[model samples]
Target: MGESGAYRRLPVAERRRQLLVAALDLFSHRPPEQVSIDDIASAAGASRPLVYRYFPGGRQQIYEAALRSAAEQLTACFTEPPAGTPTQRLRNALDRYLAFVADHDAGFSALVRGGCVTETSRTTAIIDEVRRAAAEQVFVHLGVPAPGLMLRMAVRSWIAAVETVSLIWLDEGRQPPADQLRDWLIDHFVAVLTATAAGDPQSSEVLSGFLAAVEGQPRSVR
Candidate 1:
């Protein structure tokens, strides 16, 4: 279709969606610093002015839209309870996360590694929400207090660990495959939780230290 005809035909919502999707794809391969309005326009099959018409705030707005999309996909599986034990729930969560990453690798990569988000308030809020949700889930699974200080610590550590492992996997082109990594994560969590429940002081202490270290940090998200 001609540019003017295409622009006239696309609804505002459709145009915004297209811009967000294309911007995310571009941001994944490079940081926001390297991305431009023209790149997003070409990628989205829309005119340059059309892209800006939908995203007047430019790159930052596009970055936020990308983040929202990434968050939606990643958090979808955790919205419901699994059909088994706590260990099963954790396994299921891991499976969902890996699948999301695999399917939306570009978006996930942009959000986590491409350095689009910069504002402290926005970044912290996003991280806090993700960490709180994760911690609450783990606490519920373990029959622990959800809002307790320990839960906060646990959540922070969990987020940090997940992000760290995710980056390593992404850099290595996800060596050993997502299924292998998912299984390994499940086994590790089960072992550690079992040890903690069995009153292993070393396990408790190690976990506590890890949690504390993450919680003490100011910015948990990047």
Candidate 2:
């Protein structure tokens, strides 16, 4: 039983996590600006005072915590085993990323779009950290020990595009299926990397490696 129906008090961490899970659930389906402490308390089956006990700053405090937790999850989306080719790893990563977007829905939208009532600099930093972490993971998959400016720009731009496309996918009701979107995104990454290679020798070298690895793989007929 949850704290709401419990006669005995939970340990401090359990209580806090229960409350945080409740907050994240509400945030997942709706904008954080629309979520409140009362909503979380109701969802968690706890009282307002108890939520306040755990998060004295109320909704703002809890929202940041939820965002941080979600950020970590999103950042981990780019991580994959190095066993596959770079594009294969990237496709796997995109599947995970898009799955997260589909799972989070409105929360993912709010997390990237920002401009929420309770959003703070800390929240913004958390989101940015996800972006940077994602880019770094892209570099890792490309086996680039030091990504040049052009390669960095290409990867970051692709990340931003992924975010944009994810929002569009949600708005369109997840049409085209996630696997289709994932394959298309992988193609886009290769294209962007190819374009970057035109100007940067480092990108050219990286692109050569990626293409060599992807040469024999089956790709979408486009």
Candidate 3:
């Protein structure tokens, strides 16, 4: 917190963390582009030089840090599953997902916009990982093998669907109707799994193939 001729007292990690906290607060009030390093440094109660020392690249660094913070918070929501059926678990995930967006309204909005601007944008990889993990959870819970191209496509598609739904809701400036979203997901899940569970051999076959793709196996779509 103090400084001398050539060195400051705060550790590098702590300074970066403080910078991110400051950036997140600023982002909540306005878009990322509207914010400046001075704003962040001012909010952080640190000198501009000190802020630069922690994040020399400036805005981009702060933006990425803000995103990382959001991702970490969202991931924390999924850390545990309460006692419930598969449907309950899916509902719980959706509930938590929406709650996360609502809780960090500004930061989540910025992340969505920032990520779309470039494929190389910050948080893309983190989002991808989150989606993949969610998909895996869905398939695995249904007792599917989750292998191959179908697996890949299914999980990716599923995750995209969920994210897209959430994004649309956010864009509309409405919290995704949690009950409605949960019911919809549950219905889609039941349709597939129930068909497979029934004696419908074709549905079972298709599901098995999809699950295989999810498990990293290759499958011909045709």
Task: Give the best candidate by TM-score.
Answer: 2
TM-score of each: 0.74, 0.93, 0.70
Residue 122 shift from truth in candidate 2, angstroms: 1.1
| lDDT-best of 1 and 2 | 2
Residue lDDT tens for model 1, 1-222: 237775778787887887888877776566566788888888988787787677788777777777667666556656546344444566678878777666655546655653455444675466557656766666554444424444344455656677778778877988768878887876665454445534554346434533443355322111
- Candidate 1: which stretches are off by over 4 Å? 103-110, 113-120, 140-147, 194-222
In angstroms, the error of model 3 at 86 is 1.2
Candidate 3, 13-67: lDDT as tens digits: 8777877888887876566777888898889888788877777877777677677
lDDT of 2 by residue, 17-114 (tens): 88888898899999987998889988988888888888999888999998888888888887798776777788888888888899899998887787
Predicted structure 1: clash tally: 0
- Tell me the deviation in Å of residue 77 in model 1: 3.4
* Residue 181 of model 3, lDDT score: 69
TM-score, ranked from best to worst:
2, 1, 3
